[model samples]
Target chain A: MLPLCISHGDLVKLFVIALLATTALAVASLFVGVSEISFFALLSGESNEKMLLVLGESRIPRTAALILAGAGMAVAGTIMQLLSRNRFVEPSTAGTVESASLGMLAVLLLAPDLPVMMKMLVAALFALAGTALFLGILRRVPLRSPVLVPLVGLMLGGVINACTTFFAYRYDLMQAMGAWTSGDFSAVLRGRYEVLWLALALTAAAYFAADRFTVAGMGKDFSTNLGLDYRKVVALGLLIVSMVTASVVVTAGILPFIGLIVPNLVSMAMGDRLRHTLPWVALSGAVLVLLCDTIGRVINAPYEIPVGSMLGIIGSIFFLSMLLRRRSRAA
Target chain B: MIEFSGVTKVYGSTTVVDDVTAQLPKGGITSIIGPNGAGKSTLLSMIARLIPCDRGTVLVDGLDVARTSGETLARRLSILRQDNHMTARLTVHDLVAFGRYPYSRGRITADDQAHIGRALGYLGLNDLGDRFLDELSGGQRQRAFVAMVLCQDTDYMLFDEPLNNLDIRHAVGMMKLLGNAARDFGKTVVVVLHDVNFASCYSNHIIVMRDGKLFLQGSPREIIRSETLEQTYGCPFEVQELGGNRIAVYYT
Candidate 1:
């Protein structure tokens, strides 16, 4: 008998359970906002128009944005991890988000009348440049220790963040920049969040190229030996990562740690074959953000906390625990 | 046949592999034995196209490796290097199945499954196929990597220091497996080995390298002698006949 870690049947069963859980959380998230939209009121055909308007204009879009942004950022993180061959590095740590914000600032200051899609494109370009810079620095650093990669990434992120902040303060756009950097689903009405669908499309693209990403993660030699164009795949992966991150950041602001934590959590349960684990990573990411958003809504009750703050608090704890756990294991 | 003509690799100011030109024979185990920094691994990598040569070219079955498409060359040749560190967690079965990626492109067919099974069985990993690579011992992991290379099923296979971390018994077993694969499949096996004794005992042909150059190439009997070994390694050495094989003992 093969010494299986988890059999095919078990994997399918687990996926089904995760799917059901995600559906339940998504449904529950649609009802937990400042405006009370009763599920039974819509079902029983009383005040149905008002409730439907609430659902369509606010609740549904919010829920969809949450799912798309969550899943997209998580998959983007996975791609970054694979491309950098470092688990702890993500967009938030590797200066991608800061660069995207810089692009958004550039667009807003230079051409405030541009369409949302144009803004996202500009942000994605900046993000691509930033991620490339991060990778360039990573190549020079001796990767004798794995933890050093993320440390360098964080330092790079700090530098970019400083530049962004200085500009935001100089132009007196700090308030607007603040709104773009902190995630909030309360303002996600119809047409405001459709750009996140592009993120979803990019995430789907990631699924199709999952195997190549896995091979690339093994190293350049492994990919070349397996007949894969390592440089081409890496470029495609970076493009996917940049676009997804820009879409999420443009639509719902920066969702921190969703990319860093979700993939790592899923890889712990399911192995790192992206084909098998990507869907779960997407689902789990959606579930995490949905849960956090719901909690942020309920805990403040009519006032509401931004999802970014909630995730920041939770994600930092998880990040610290992961670092400690890895250190202990190494010891 | 694998041919290297005036192949050279340079890093910064150092000439790592200095104009190496040699033809490795087909259908047998040819071992490259050299001391540290002697460019054995670099030469093997050049032949496999893992690294481009600063000058000249490598031809595999008359196809220039530098000009051939990666997919076409991968079907014909495969190479595994030392220190296969991976951030992603993979099972032995999954890792071996990747050997079929050149043909299947991530979609596994029945024929690919058969090849995977055969490679796993050849490496005595049938029962351990489902085990994660990190859960396995160093020797088991080495065998798993070898199994992956075998599953590639290329005409020419290159391994750079395959016995880096294995114990004596496993090292011997690994050499025997390479020998068997060469004989059974009629594949060309080129290995960079640090142990001269293993090369003398198991290899049909041996290439000696010294100071980034090919010093000698011949049958094991000619290359494993005391004078040739001492010249290549720049150390005192004694040669002995054991079981119809000339073994080099350098213990002072």
Candidate 2:
């Protein structure tokens, strides 16, 4: 009735395109490695014992981890944007991942013998609390420009990271905390990488919460007028966001800017149809992280750069370019 | 029928709407006219549940507005505030389509589409449906907001300063639209307006407010007199008969 632009046909076409692009990036991620496993020898698997281990255990899981982490972060960003009614909010931008990292560090320091799920639960609780605190501050401090909200969020995140760093340094646990926050994919082997599948489950929960979030963005009165319990929607959104952040933190440390960058690009292209944008944001996010991970591996041939470091450098440059373009247009 | 029983809203030490009790009858154009800081908008917001009353309750067709769920009241009543600023980049069609959200929740059905098309046609916005709200003039945007309220298709419609940015022609068109909605569609229309001439000309029932109290309520013929207008607005107003309508001339 409203001109079904993304009908079944258009949906199939866009998804197929997204799937093909992501698959290409995934294959590139596997073969383009920094180790001594040349492509010819890895394919043959005939004379190289160490190459098999790198190919089977390391490359495959890392690529899978990249895709999983990217999709989870992008979906989480979309939900946060819808919930807060701000386009620039992402898990990392809003201090969600940093808070979760702090929680994980606490678990490592305090309860090192706890189960992996328990540690993740603690991290999720901290991430949710952090997001709630940020939103509360947003309500109290009225921002004139949309740009100021994200900048405020970034400063808040910096504060949280500063606190985490100070404690980690004091206790001589800086090395452990550093590894978790820098996002190294080299450790995402078979046994350690199952936590990322939880993100796939969170993606489904995100779809269920998208409609409620859209209504909630219309203002508290309007959402209540539409029969949506605003507090419940906000809580559900925070829970999904926190869980996604915790899983990504526990699995691959911190992947910067995927949550912030990918969703903005998808919204620009596809409009803010959550039903339509969710899948595309996920696929594009996976592709971007995979591409970035591959580039990081190829750029420094022997000793690889961390994906988080590479994303920080490249993503910030791209984000700054976008900001300049927007400023020029406004001028 | 909508009833407000001793609905008093107090802001801090100040009472904005003080002990206001009134019953607005069904199926007529009722206009509330008052001076600045008379608590007209505050009263309207309390009735629409946009602002909660501290002391009393409002009932819309016998359903307690405060106790009933917002969605339930939303089906029977709709309100358009003075400011309708949107953060999203939306076309006129997109803005109007949100009127159907109470029913379709953004998934537009055939019935919803029909209502949207009709509202657009009624408001003479068929051509401007695809244009952005920012691209239109202020009067056109006002008309678009009114069209959204009409598309909502509720039994009770409330508007606060609906003609704030309209020129003379568009203002008359808006008053005529509200009048027609009340007369033809059997809907109760309540508007808060500063223009006494428009209220005198179009409204069947009129209420005058002063200093956060309902000072007078009656037919336009009873309340649109020179003395009442003078006392309510604290300005000189000459009530003159113009083309079988009571016209309050206060432009001096």
Candidate 3:
């Protein structure tokens, strides 16, 4: 193994570089769309009301939602990985997103008149319960191999997704379920995406508690030896992960892989100290989502591909390569 | 002083530690030695409050370990388990800095920094402080853990099989380090040792366990006799005195 430790100065420098890249991507995402919103026209003060309306309503909110969801999901993934002590475990694989989808479906069928905020809360509660169940199952399984954890999570996710699909088909709400499950930011208006701001707050809270999560990652014995209440920290971590998953799923649908890929890549390079690597993870996640969303918009100019499909294709490749690489190295 | 009266631990109908009641004197090195499945580690863990006792009371300086707050017990005692597997990728310095968590709570103060530096130097890990733990040798990693325990600066320190994957030189060095800590700092050092010879040579007091019970407790001179060793280990043993230390030589 190479020397994986980097100085604090290098970490800060890396963070700056990542921030700049995310900013550039965010700026680029603002301009790429079906409508022609040129930078010069906006800056020239020509008073293009229609273009201003498009920028404010569609472009800005979409970009903001992309950034918030990206950062929040990635931070949530980091916390989940630490709490579970397994690198492969994330919200998407751990049945959190599927549970949130189920909650959204329930709300749509039972109380269609409820506000979007209430829907998000319902989804968050369901997500929390589902994640707790996943943890309970994990505790029962003999964790002799690291791969067993994510396998159990993926199996749980598959079961929940199957139930969700069956319910959608039975209730004849398949189209609505499709809209909730596919991650597309095209319909994100100004008022529609404010729920994602809660994800932003949760992400910040995760950062503030990063040190505790890092200590908790060392395992229960280490935490107790250090005088920390391990159970409380793990509970807070699970709550943050569920809420972030629910908010993102509610706002723009399920963005897979951002939670799994971003944190793994960041920790591979920067070590697992959350206080140092979390900002990098957040920035990388935002950059990935913004770039993919931009590509999805540009590839089929008039007809946009959903960002969820785009991320699914990209994230699966990363996931496969990571698994293969780990296996080959172990062998 | 650490006192445990009627401390017991049972796992699935088997009493791992059966009514172990003893008093460990402060300010010296005490070694607990026994055969496999004798519950040496379990007793140490109960004293450190790592695992809850099935039924008993453990008092560290008169504060009940089961009732006292973890933070308060942490300030008074520290324990290092045998298997220290962690998912986090931490450098030697980062791992040792966690020792100050009881006082600083993850924020490294100037005093904590001083303690960390001294621990690194004491363990001869000054140059390896920046190295990741997985990149180091087994002996170096063991020393790093000991360095962390030393940096904790507690009055009492408990180690479970501290010499588990080390070479002879490193094992001797670890025992010397523990001896130095007890002599220089007046700290109470308790260790679970597998090698009875090592226990006989270094420890000021010795505890012997068998079949989940305390079989004997005495100084090295009293416990290193041939008949006592045979009774405890159920093997033939020859004891010889060399350089004022009783060495046990067992027949195969």
- Candidate 1 scores an fnat of 0.79
Per-model interface RMSD values are: 1.2, 3.4, 1.5
Top TM-score hit: 1
lDDT ranking of the models: 1, 3, 2
Model 1 TM-score? 0.98
DockQ of each: 0.79, 0.35, 0.68
- What is the C-alpha lDDT profile of model 1 across B137-208, one tens digit per residue? 988898899999999999999999899778888888889989988998898999999889999998989998
Docking class of 3: medium
Where is model 3 more than 4 Å wrong at Cα? A1-6
> Chain B alone, model 3: TM-score?
0.98
lDDT of each residue in A1-331, candidate 2, tens digit only = 1233446687778689869878887877777766666766656756387777887888888999999888998888888887777777888889898899989888988999987778888999989888998999899999977778888889989999998999899989998898899887878887787788898889877876655665565566556555456788888889988998898898888888887788777766555656556788888788878877888788888668888998888778877876787678778
Candidate 2 chain B weakest lDDT stretch, 10 residues: B83-92
- Any idea what lDDT model 1 has? 0.90
Tens-digit lDDT string for candidate 2 (B1-252): 999988898888988998999999999899999999889999998888888899988999999888888777777898888876653335687678777877877788999999999999988999998776767888899899889889889999999999989999888888998999999999999999998888889998988888899999999999999998888988888998989998988888
Candidate 3 lDDT over A1-331, as tens digits, reads 1245556787678678868878888988889988899998878887489999999998999999999999999999999998888888899889999999999999988998889899999999999999999999888776887877888899998999998899899999999998978899988999999999999999999989988999899888888887888889999998999989999998899998888889888877767878777888888888888888999999998899999999899989988898888789789
TM-score, per-candidate, Cα-based: 0.98, 0.90, 0.97
Candidate 2, true inter-chain contacts retained: 0.19
